[model samples]
Target chain A: MIAALMTKKEWITNNVRRKNLGAHVLGVTAFAGGHIAVHWLMPSGQVVQDNWDMHGLEFPSLTVELPEMAWDEREIHDVFGYRPQGHPDLRALVRNPRWPDEFYPMAGLNAPQKPPWREVAPNNPEQTVEGEGVTIMKVGPTHAGIIESGHFVFSIIGENILHLDLHLFQNHRGVEGQLQGRLIGSVAPLISRICGADTVSHQTNLAMAVEEMAGYQVPDEIKWQRILLLESERILSHLNDLAQIPAGVGFSVANQKALTMKERWQRGLTVIFGHRLLFDTVHPGKSLAMDTAALGALITQLQREWRPWRSLVQGHHGFQDRMKGVGMVRQSDALRFGGQGVVARASGLTFDARQLMPLYHGWHVDYASETSGDVSGRFKVRLDEVEASWRLMQGVLQRYQIHSALPFWEPPTDLIGQAATFSESPHGLNAHIVAVDRGKVIRYHVRSGTFRNWPLLSKAVAGNAVGDFPLINKSFELCYSCLDR
Target chain B: MGKSIQVLQLRHVDAGSCNGCEQELTALGNRFYDMQHSGIDVVASPRHADGLVVTGPVTDTMKRPLMQDWDAVPEPKWLIALGDCAAGCGVFQGAYACYSGVASVRPPDLVIMGCPPLPQDILRQITVWRKTLD
Candidate 1:
């Protein structure tokens, strides 16, 4: 259904009271046309949409009732110069003083009067720990490992963390702004790079959204091929996450083993697709070149190799000891904050988009969930998802025939309109919203799983030690590029 | 060829990378490549390192921190720019938040080019550097 626009006050009053509509805020996105689109992810996983037209630069904020709206609203303020009136903490999110507060990248305005760029004082919150032994520690923007930029400030008394604050967006590259006004066919590469590790997921989700907008129906053969690609991507990403847990615990043997499997899986991708990370492998109305025989062999190899390696990692007592109870995120907290993927599943919320949405091509997946709400529970969920992905891949290979020929779809000319799609990314639910006009993208917004789950990290590490932070952080295995973009 | 160090202790810096390079770096340490076997190690701190293995276009916010990391490594340390992002800013070139490439901060001693260079390619590059010591 097309989303209807309402005056800011009316939309809030009607939605906040859940008046005649059982809807929850899925996400809110701002565009260059000077409007905010609010999506409601209903209980049945169908998205109901609405818009708030900001006549001026200010609009009533919905964050008072929905704490999750804080980030969404602040992002709009940063990029579009639209203010969410009554927002608790409206600071520069994606932009710092280096870009000048007046210069909104996506506002797309003509040259106007502006002051010279200058470094602003860091807007980080002052430490509030009032006790005698409390101390503050800061990490990252550049961490010890091969990771992206983000700052975590921990207020601790000895080893127990009293409070933690996450300051992300240090790596923002104006990705969304870059997509604005580009041809629909051209943005796929940019979307793929939004997060390299999950390139397939981003590309597939964007393709689905574009296809929907253009009213193109993929052929059955290509549909099955896309499913195979999706499941392959999921299995490989889960394996990578599974390895991180062991590596964080200092179990080099298990870490090396799991990583080797991940490497082999990626090498298989490179052999078939010509890129280890599958860059530009999937595009709107098209699938990149693939050799059926190589794909079949790779799937078979993954199916055979994964079982014993999974057992080896899970059966280790020392690994279990480090993960069992560390970084516990309560079920209630996860739900309240709109957590998705591993963060939500481990806390006993079983909301996988593949099962709930129509994007899975009618295949029902049996996803796993654990109520333990700890690091071990998250690992268990990853293992279960990996197995499920493996079964799906095996099923695809089993159905393929050597003599069969599959056709790829071509993009339609004169494509126009808007579309929003969600898929079960390895991290969680990933949403891509696009608006097209005259075959050009006017606006694009990505609500990745990492953005949803990042808030949960601070809450999870509330009482954990500083040393345990890496293990806890790795369990979620978030993609900083996805979050930063 | 005989004047090279046997061990290359490196520190990774992510200025503004998409993390494609970081994944390859992790794979380099896996059983397939096993970087430690070649006497190449990734250290946690720059103070204990002989070089900085950098990724991504250096962003305005990360410029100070990246340079501080580079300065922390003692003399005779090398600067290796990994991936197209580090070499020429890749897709994020001319971005308002970035300085384009690592060369804007300092000339790189070695530049490995790819959207994200394959793990084997990275390992091979290091291996060739190791062979120069013979």
Candidate 2:
């Protein structure tokens, strides 16, 4: 019944388009009316149709013309029930290559049986290799280091690594799968969990998406508060990453000093935000409720406290020696992988989301980028970012004022309109695309900064020795859960 | 003179966790509550030395390894129960594999509260533990 309804709508749409009327009129009507009919020509010369609800009208309806000869040539008929007449990569899209022909009857259809594919290969290539006197050293999904979980399988030829493969995803929490059918408000907590260090940034992006979709306009005060929170998150994360660089190379003093500086920052956050990690501080449509004058006073206090600490770590020769020229990710590689935040900026990519696309009105931000692309360059970039964040916070506190109405705003229900919401997270550009049908979220997609940069970690580790894994890992600092989700 | 201390982290092994506890543990070194500078570092291996900071309740598969790790860490090392899961098994207590919290395997020198205590709370506990060692 649904397919027939879709077919009738497709016929009307095609007929109207053929008569010289605009297809967008029908598209807009279908989108606003809650469903769009998608028409496809089947391989058997029959036209098939499917009705998809237009929740978020962010992406336009697309129809492609394909050559019939290319359809049967590629095995799309085996995987998904229907095949596009022509697709560029016929063999590249299948999830399971080992599955039998009888399993996948058509494109988009269920397989007869689940293929015995390993989620993680235990004796992965990164783990072992055949070489004279080569011994396997397993690092961890859990390690005795200051970093997160990512098991390293290193084939060491007498303390020199011959092969190394990073095994990750031990901490995968299925955040995206948990987000299905949840209200915008309910998904904030889940989004924040994607990367613990960037909680504020994640929530900020989620909030922006919700606000844009609900057509809710947050006040200037709230926007500034969000910025402040985001900067704080950046400072905390950068400080942690900076400290780990020294620790990875076994420079205890610098590690300890960096940790001390980090503690001071966290204590300041706890004093003002009521939690050290700054969880649940910003929510959709809610402006951070704190006295501006008092917060300004606190920012001043942190600045005075952080300066000496920052100088101490930066001045250390031993720290600089280990970080310099270690785990260098060139500018070209950074650009190819679309790396962002301090990592990309350090590699000479000036693609800061805040500077690239300004979200807060009347606020100006200045940041520095370096082209060294080494661990030291990354460290310097983070240090500069932390200092810049501190300055940005001070500026925010000075300009902030008490407002009567809270900054919380709801997404608009209009489907025929276009809205894009963005936030410059600690990681990078966090964008949300929302298309509303009547008053419901038709389509919601979150493009986290971490999602764009994680693959670069594997690339950076390709030629480097086994010892460089931790340094390289810390350099990029990509959040796995964020990307996995 | 202060005794040189090293931290050894143990995975009590919650098969599927909401990850709130893990986040709290990760935040131990962040800029508002720095754990490492205070001589508290989360080491990857159990064989390294010093204290054990365990998060989550013990699961069936994780039970033997948890015991093995607890045994692996050198003697005179402190054992800390982090988060509610480590304290009293929290939400995953009734799961098939999970029997109890960190106490199920070994006694805890410290038990920090909250579903996951804030970084400050974690640092405070570590500081107190260090003082006790002195």
Candidate 3:
């Protein structure tokens, strides 16, 4: 049965190949097949087509059929080093054991067999001068401040960082692979867990994906509510960051002030939204439980409390001294690596998904960016963002009061379709792609803002002294489990 | 230049924990209960730390790293067991990787109980540590 399905898939793929039409091949198996499934995509946009087999096999295997004429045998050999026996090009191959078979699993019979392992040839090692006092300082995976776990091996020559290699992934949660076949509604909680600091942002992206998949247009009132919650998330996170910077520099008074303000913000969230972090507040196919009058009251309360605190923190000279130029990220770096949120905005890269691609279609939002890529830049960007969010929240509240009936749409009951959605999260622009089959999420791809900033973070730390690592890391504040997953 | 108190912090390791104690430890630096204002800071490297703040239940894999962290910190440092988990392994005592608490790895100078004590509670313990230092 397995062989029969593979042959049918191959035949279909070959026929499509002759017509220059793109085709996707998918395989699903039960019980004895070890529950292995394969999903293949062509250049043309098409939902993964499945070929099922019910065969008694010890291990599960899935294969994708490719056209022989159009196949790149040389590229395959370079990547996997397994050349098909009857393939056109078999000479340009490098045999290796570390080839990726786990990610792209293919059938063994039609595929090329594994080549012989090549012996690792040793290169001449570089000579090192014997130094009297050289200490290897390792900091990582666990540390002080609001930074995630990652190992940094610093070969220091008396306080100067001579060589540094960052080894991360202490908080790997495998969230991406876990999203496969999960119902669209079920993905919110999983997205929320991506990063505690940016919980609302991740969930918003997931919610947007679901909304898009279902062709459901969110009510204007709910949209405003989402913006309010998103701003609240920003205020809390920025306050937390601001508080940590002062604490790092041993400024007790400043740290205390920031912390207190942050607590107040959290408390307000709890009072208004029923949760401090607003976890599970805005979900797919659900309206915000809070009333318009209550939301307006909360907004008034927040405005009264936040204005003075913001002014006090901004006016502090000592805090400014510690923050300004502490960790500078250049605009070039930000643009090249696709840095997101405050990190990208601080470096003068103006890219906010809300302004760029407004999901609700007609909503207007105020966006801000900064030029200085230092700690001060990040602080300023976050500060400005807080203000912008506050303004947006107010706008949303006013709109909600005026617009009595908000439109809510439901998901289209169709199988084999794709939908993509983008939302402005606390971190940055979060994009989620949903492939659905009859209202169930067949596969979900979440490209979080944090994931986009990982490479930039590693680059930011490079060339800076070892002492500034903690401060630099805090400035970027990339989520570990979010990226790891 | 003047007489200064040297602080060396030891970060405890746990295989799996609820993170309640960690939150409390983090809260110590917040506005409500400012530990840094009291001259107490959470250091990343154990070598330069003056105290060890152990939270959560001990696990088999975490045993070596926890011991290594403890050993790495200089002598004349204090060990504090924070939370019920650190005091007696709490809810994860009989779980697969979890063994016990700070006692399983090293002797603790102080044991503060609660699933996770409040920031004020953490502040009170720090005050006690300062008094002991004097």
Candidate 4:
């Protein structure tokens, strides 16, 4: 980890636009005392962190050089009132019309002033494509079924789609704003709520980041337990995605079969770990450790449950016909958009956080990549990952022999610096940046896999049939709550 | 209005939920819970629904829509708050984005509590509601 203090202009010119750069921007965060930090990850797991001291809310934007920085910059603007001078699109990202114009929530700029009660626009209007018979169909903010609300406006002619304008943040809850001044230890439960499906990953990422801040390390047994929790989360989330795919194509039987397996898997997790979703199960330097016997039984149960569904789903031709060659994300586009996890892997980009980070070094998990970059590709990647997670759990259980749970390591109260960490979430790479001052959190930023992958969704859905939107969307499984948070 | 209804059509409104409640709600329809067997059907629109199965703490952005949907529900419709968030904002209470649960918008006939109540819990609540009506 390398942290450098540079001028905003120098930082942008030197690092943001530099050719032959090996790092990807994790996120841009803002601190109370005029500090702007950009967390980046080099190809070799090394974090190249840069902090610029700004007098006020003005800073040089990196959007021109790296388009992916646009969302982060906009969020920074919304949260901290940081004016990104050169940002191409400086529209309100998360701050809705309900929020007062000058009040910034994250920085706590205007605490005494309550935002006035007024009627506000429900969502931002989409940029429509103008042409003859180019009708637009808008879906969600409040969707059918139990899915997260995200408004997608599809400009279509007949059944073919021309462009999909996505408007997320309808569920934005100002999660970062709420985390301020809390003890580092108390933030896990709140972090878990950032996204429900990937609760373990969110907690692990936040936990790992806070632990890094305090310079603490867990015992091997606890480390394995954390990995076990993470892998279990991955398996269940991927299974959820798998079920969605079959359901998307009207294959209800296959869908139910997979969902039943997932339920059984989750039930086993609940029996062993005490929480079906495993919320608050992981904390800094420790996790809710499972007994070796229960874990073994869970693994055996999973093996028995997964085999039949895996065989049937993989062999089914109708499911394949619907999933294959649909929602294709090109290699160049994936790279350009900074795609991570299944979205990138399916596009043949071998960019998994586990492969890069030291935390997951000992875990013998296989990286699943498919060059097709289609719905089938993403589906196949998720299926392979579920199997890989199952294998990893089996491996961890075999190697670690312990009768009781590992003892928790206490975090030092004296924390003064920033710590950034990333984890392979079920959807993609989940990155968290934490800034602490004297034991209390000053700045906390969580960039979920959905945040990174949502951009790719708009790109991927283009040129596909209007009816294929659900299938394409289900394949991505991007959570609006995570993105909104 | 007084007639005993056979099929209960539920329209789910996500009033700033954490997706946890939504997950459990989705699971209720799966083979394990099989909510359809009990005559609870999740319709696409509130116009065609008998009740509103709501989730999340009513956020500023979603409050208007939630109220609009509530008004859209026909006479003799039930409003069931699905999780702690909807029941009373759960942990997300007092946050800037939240309006302190769906009860703030309109008091629910039934409130299912849990950070996110399980599918079985939801099924049990629906069954209880069914029994009371019968």
Among these predictions, the greatest TM-score belongs to: 4
Model 3 lDDT tens row, A46-79: 3333333423322212112332211223323333
Per-residue lDDT tens digits of candidate 3, residues B1-134? Answer: 13257442445443223344554577666766666777778876777787667765654334455666778877766788887767874644443234567787777888888655656777787677667665
TM-score of the first chain alone, every candidate = 0.92, 0.71, 0.70, 0.94
Local accuracy of candidate 4 as per-residue lDDT tens digits, B8-93: 99899887787888888888888889899988889999998988988888777888878888898888888998888888857677
- Interface RMSD for model 3 amounts to 9.6
Q: What tens-digit string does per-residue lDDT give for candidate 1 at A106-211?
A: 7763212233557654344544567789998888877887788888888999999999888888787767766766778877777888887777788888888888
lDDT of 4 by residue, A36-142 (tens): 77778888788876777776668888878777777888888887787888899878778777787777777663222235635777666577798999998888777
* Per-model DockQ against the true two-chain complex: 0.57, 0.17, 0.14, 0.67
| Interface CA RMSD of each prediction in angstroms | 2.9, 7.7, 9.6, 1.8
- Rank by TM-score, highest first: 4, 1, 2, 3
Task: Fill in the DockQ of model 3.
Answer: 0.14
Candidate 2: docking tier: incorrect
Would you estimate the TM-scores of all the predictions?
0.93, 0.68, 0.64, 0.95
Best by DockQ: 4
Residue ranges of candidate 4 with Cα displaced over 4 Å: A1-9, A17-19, A109-114, A403-408
C-alpha RMSD in Å of predicted model 2 compared with the true structure: 10.3
Residue-wise lDDT of candidate 2 within A1-485, one digit each (tens)?
24433343464455334323211111111222334333322223222334544333221222222121121223223233233322453432222233344443222111122333333322222436886797888765444543344456777676566666555444332233233233444555556555556778767766766665556777777778888888888888777777777767787767766676667677777777766677778877776557666667766776776678677767878777777776777787675454667778888878666753445446767786898888888888887888788788888887777756664445443433334455666777665544444443444444567655665555566556677777777777776544433
CAPRI grade of model 1: medium
Model 2 chain A worst lDDT window (10 residues): A22-31
| Candidate 1: C-alpha lDDT | 0.79
